[model samples]
Target: MQWQNVAINKMIEEAILEADKKGTKVVSLGLMNQGEELNIYGGLYVSRHPKLKVKIVDGSSLVVALVLNTIPKGTTQVLLRGKLNKVAYAIAFKLCQQGIKVATMHEDDYVKLKKSFNSSEANLVVALNFTQTVWLVGEGLTEEEEMKAPKGTLFIPYSQFPPKKYRKDCSYHYTPSMVAPNSVENLHSCEDWLPRRVMSAWRIAGIVHSLEAWNEHECGYTMHNIDMVWNATLQHGFQPLNLPNHTVIT
Candidate 1:
């Protein structure tokens, strides 16, 4: 794990250097790059680097905005499944603040929940980790059980399942990976598969941060500030979710 972190950080530093050479104004860290163990330290490294000319941003706020935007109109109950990382915790907190009821379960509890479910109870299920999402869809329940599952929506960042492999009749599925072409090259980067609108949202946030940084302006922004990020995403042509945007597993 220590070696992995060092390697990841090295890669990030190299990317930052490349961005500087290209005169890029900002660099945005995606997914695992902004994960719990690295976000703060990575930001500090970039901010303190004398030779780094570009600003560093993370996708946390943008992701929250996109996920919230995907919620169905009538969704009153939400289940957040994954390890309780910073991103998951923040998303849950915001949902509760908006008066939506939420339940949280770790990845280990997924099998137990799947077995106990007689009918779908959650209106929405947000799986923060791709592996956990795969487990939930594949081994977590039987086909009949999944078909009878009551969840209205399943939101995952990506999936390894083919488009036609999962039960579509049960829940609405949203994943960037689902729309990607069936080619190995297309699978190289998570960004390649992410829905265009979602990616647009993240880009918009990055641009805003870049502009602020360039102007020596402090907007006093943090990942927990959802409204600002959501508004920016809207400006970049993010379509609102149609209720029950259902699909089979990706």
Candidate 2:
């Protein structure tokens, strides 16, 4: 009955996994409303290795940890479900500490994001002017610039606040043809091809084997989906047109 929410959550999780495989660090971020709701969504954080442990905490603690980039020695990641502003600041501060590059977005867009998240009116102005960060979520869609969020700003996509269905003609611009529909049909074994658009690096071993069996007559399907450049990363990598880190809030 509530399949949409499931799909959305799966999308975000898949993105994190795919991004992680590509060696891109991700961190989950969000703002918890009175009912503990998130506005910006979340992401995965990368560290020095694959099997690193992470810390999960309330929004405030996340901010402190991210701002300092000081997790306990065994921690490699952080997950937060809290206020949008605080989480954003933590992400920005931590990125700065690690010397990681970020992306920038248009100014008007930033203003709108601040207002939507109910961020401090005064701080909104200062944050907009002082930071060049990308507003990751907006109106059930992610800003294009979020793909490479800049330093000093939040990167949660608008879609994270109220997860929306993708449209073929209007709000979103992707076409079915953009994704190999036949390839999708052939991936029935996975029972969830839609998530692959964003989460490409994950192998889904058993499902992949099934796909291989189904395509035994053909020889190049894997290469088509694995070697070619799809969005920003290789076919086997996560390059979602919508920033992969954006959460699909429930």
Candidate 3:
């Protein structure tokens, strides 16, 4: 089900209030898939200044599904997406089935929701739990917000997912193949459709790292085999983006 800004804002406000009680400002890290776009799923933290220091990472390497796996069962995660689509919803449904409570909303109403929610639900606060995961869609936070994230926030990009769903809502032209392989390519070549975004993202970084992570017995990573993609991008002088260790950069 598509989440309303009210629910997500409430969750974040609760998180912020708890932070305030601890005598700390609200520290949040937003990971988006785009570099220039700042429209988060509800535009809660849209930068008003052009010089807004946001850390625009190469989301080109993130896999939404793998990140989802990182979240524990029975926990609620605030999901921020630019364009809510069926594929994403399908993922959420699967999580709900696993007992995960996923919160969703449009980008425009984020800040307002946060204010209202915190006012209403004082007990529903999000503590600085290292294990808690925040899933960001569209673009990463500006440099300023990155520094504000609580100790253990995983910042990721949007290219990790197919562009079909979000591109329409985007004003700029976004090439899905810029980082990850196409869905058709994933289905026809890899025999696995689910992890296309994940595999495609890693392939952009370094093939060796991608192969290592995919071959991990415990995780069982799968996706379209696109090792040649690395050779092309690297040949063009594109360096690997410095992402999390769970993420591989060339």
Top candidate, metric lDDT: 1
The alpha-carbon RMSD values of the candidates against the true structure, listed in the order shown, are 9.1, 16.7, 20.7
Cα lDDT tens digits for candidate 2, 2-93: 47545654564555566556654223222221112221222122222235232111223212322232222333222211223433443433
Clashes per prediction? 3, 23, 20
Better of 1 and 2 by lDDT: 1
lDDT of 3 by residue, 47-86 (tens): 3222222211122222334334334344465344444332
Query: In model 1, what is the error at residue 57, expressed in angstroms?
Result: 1.0
**Model 1, CA-based lDDT:** 0.48
Better of 1 and 2 by TM-score: 1
**Superposition error at 29 for model 3 (Å):** 31
Score candidate 3 by lDDT: 0.34
Candidate closest to the true structure, highest TM-score:
1
Error of 2 at 224 (Å): 31
> How many clashing pairs does model 3 include?
20
Model 3 misplacement above 4 A: 1-64, 72-76, 105-133, 139-151, 156-158, 161-243, 246-250
